[model samples]
Target: MFIGRQHELIALQRMYDSKRFEMMVIYGRRRVGKTALIDHFLDGKTALYFTARQQNSRLILQSFAMAIAAYFNQPEVDFRSWDNAIDYLVSQARRHAGDKLVIVLDEFPYAAEAEPSLPSILQIAIDHGLKDTNTMLILSGSNQGFMESKVLGVHSPLYGRRTGQIKLQPFDCFDAARFVEHCTAEDAVRYYATFGGTPYYLAQLDPQLSYEQNVAMLCFDQAGLLYEEPMMMLREELKSPAIYDSILQAVSNGCNTPKIIADHIGLEPTSVSFYLKTLEELRLIERSIPFGEKPTSRKSRIHIKDPFFAYWYRFVAPNVTLIETGSGVEIARKTAESAVFATYVGQQFETMCMQWIFRAFRSGKLPLMPVLTGKWWGNNPLKREETDIDVVAAEPDEKKILLGECKWRNTVNETEMIASLRDRIGLIRGYRETTLAFFTKNPVHETTLAKYRNDPDMIFVCADDMFRER
Candidate 1:
């Protein structure tokens, strides 16, 4: 089940091989495989691993002392204070069996929660003695905000003390597709969109079952594993789950602007922004801007970056009462026939296309390379309506751009689609020459495709291209 995270494992390995003191801050949202990554990295190494829980500080200290006692083959050692325990660790490191004594404090925020001065104690130990010693320290947690503000921020005692950090992101569509086997391209995409790239969620999927059956089993039923996971995660991180729930619901329901989300939640825009920022810091939501827009642009929009959260709020949460009453199978069948589900999958497909295009562009398959790739939308004067562009790549310094539209459906005509693309591209006046591209599940009409086939500045990707990596 340990599928991805080769890059993070390599980073941690280098720190271990450095034979010097190293502090790495690893944090992300829950179920994102933080512990799994650490476990994978520390395999075959006799490192001292300690996991902190939500107990009293005295109990935590007792538990850590027991682990240390087991590690050092001592008979039930005890500690007078946390400082004493850390000094024993430093002493062990000075005479450790290996060149480096790896020490991982997993769920570090929980320890700090139980003991308010835990970070300060660690900081004092590092500053006074273990600065260049071979005690490689890895503090890992799932609380993104707490780890950032209390451990990495400038005002914290541990600030500017870490040698490296890894904000472990979920796998992309390509890596996510690897979890599904013996499925069609469409079914593979369906599984990926439903569970996203989180290894835990994807592992819960049954490859033998149909997509609808799996949805009924995993989401449409009250006993489903994922049915309670979102709420549990929010409660674990946020103090007010009711407010955060409303915010997630509003954003997933298509409320992108801050004022729009505020209006939907019946809160002031300021409060809405504050909650959204908290969600963003937790890596639960993301704010997006146009490809080449300035970083300070106010036109940014909020969206649920996690695909599982999006599917839950959009489909599962609203029908929970119906599901609990034992009509979940019928509801899931109805969901399969609904156009809304298709549209949701279409949006996920758009993200896949944009990502695939970026990779292809970087590998010299495209005519021009781009430094920035994002979604772009703006006013349309010719059609007297708003224009939306699914994928836009910009090389601002080179004055080049690539415009693309992604379609998940089977029917796409070339002439009509290209004409529409022309009108939408005409609305934006920036690059000297903008190439048109299409990424669809099906191929385009050949007559119209032939026109662009000879054009040097065109790129085309279909479903086969997206799934070929598997």
Candidate 2:
């Protein structure tokens, strides 16, 4: 079943119904459901959908020719080249006489990879034939860099030909949780944290199976579906998977700074930066700075953006030899041991809280909207010390700042925590209004709750409220 992507569906359908010549480009990482989304839109329409494979140009052309024949309800037509394939579609569109004919060219970069001149051919088709008719050509690819630089960049022949583009990102925690069946909100959160909102990973989780069983089945055994996923993920988009894996593993294991990652990976900082930039473009990692810091700030740090990668690198990657040697049970047991996984989950829980807070601000559920939300950590000039705030939302023009803290601890001195947050708020100067918010995985302390019970400007969010409402 389709779990999410309502927004993308609506936008695509609106364009489909516009009754104009349109060329849409859709790109994302693999298994993000670009094909599925297109399928959903093409269900009731007269469409020709061809998925290009990792085959030679001749074979790809043959497959597309077969689709063209099937669409026109005629015998298979022999296509000479990619130019012929695209021109055949353009001819069909022109013959349709203003009636809408949707054409989906999935895995377009693969086709281009097989044939270097495919994009130029597409450009010609769009300019002379397809654009003049009521043809809706949707080019979709998993090669993000290729699609962006080769097809969408200004110097490319296909530049300015796309009517619109959809860069489909993975689902967020709340949206991803919808895919699980009969799971409680907390369990769903764990599921999202482990799968990192990828539909391909989430689909493998059985509703009947316990979480431990699913983790064991998917991640522990040598022959498990996700056991070798770390390499599999990088192999698709990168030349050498080992280096990227090492860098990602380093970040997962707390080597966040570029210098630290360089030291761990035995690469120089400049070399590490190139690798980090590639990973960042792939959306596998995050580089965060203080809320309003410029790009050159020394306070920047890298983080593993994908929860599954973090879990894999921290737990599975390091334990690969043991698992490969048929120690599945031992690996699972070791993974379940101690508070390490809990600490990781606590970090992911804070990220989800910030996401929820940003959503609330966007939907007018908050007291004031913010221009951007980020974590703040720098020298506190007023306090003459260093201070780190978990989450901060800034509205510079309005002089309003939202200071937030997340606690995943089972017990806490809530009064002192709030007091510390108040002090941090004082450190943040130039904001006329400041809102201090606290999020916790456990229940809010009764004393702290009673104190802020009457304060609207103060926000106290507990796990129960977040899970129940988000």
Best by lDDT: 1
How do all models score by TM-score? 0.95, 0.95
Compared to the true structure, candidate 2 yields what TM-score? 0.95
Q: Candidate 2: where is the Cα deviation over 4 Å?
A: 97-99, 381-385, 445-447
Looking at candidate 1, what is the lDDT of residue 420?
84
Q: Candidate 1 deviates by what RMSD?
A: 2.0
Superposing every Cα of model 2 onto the true structure, what RMSD results?
1.8
lDDT of 2 by residue, 283-356 (tens): 89999988778988888889988888877888888887888889886777667654887777778887888877
Find the 10 residues in a row with the least total lDDT in model 1: 422-431
- Candidate 1 runs further than 4 Å off: 293-299, 445-451
Candidate 1 on 148-209: residue-level lDDT in tens?
88999999999988999999888887778778766877887777778888888888888788
Per-residue lDDT for 307 in model 2?
82
lDDT over C-alpha atoms for residue 299 of model 1:
79
Residue-pair clashes, model 2: 0
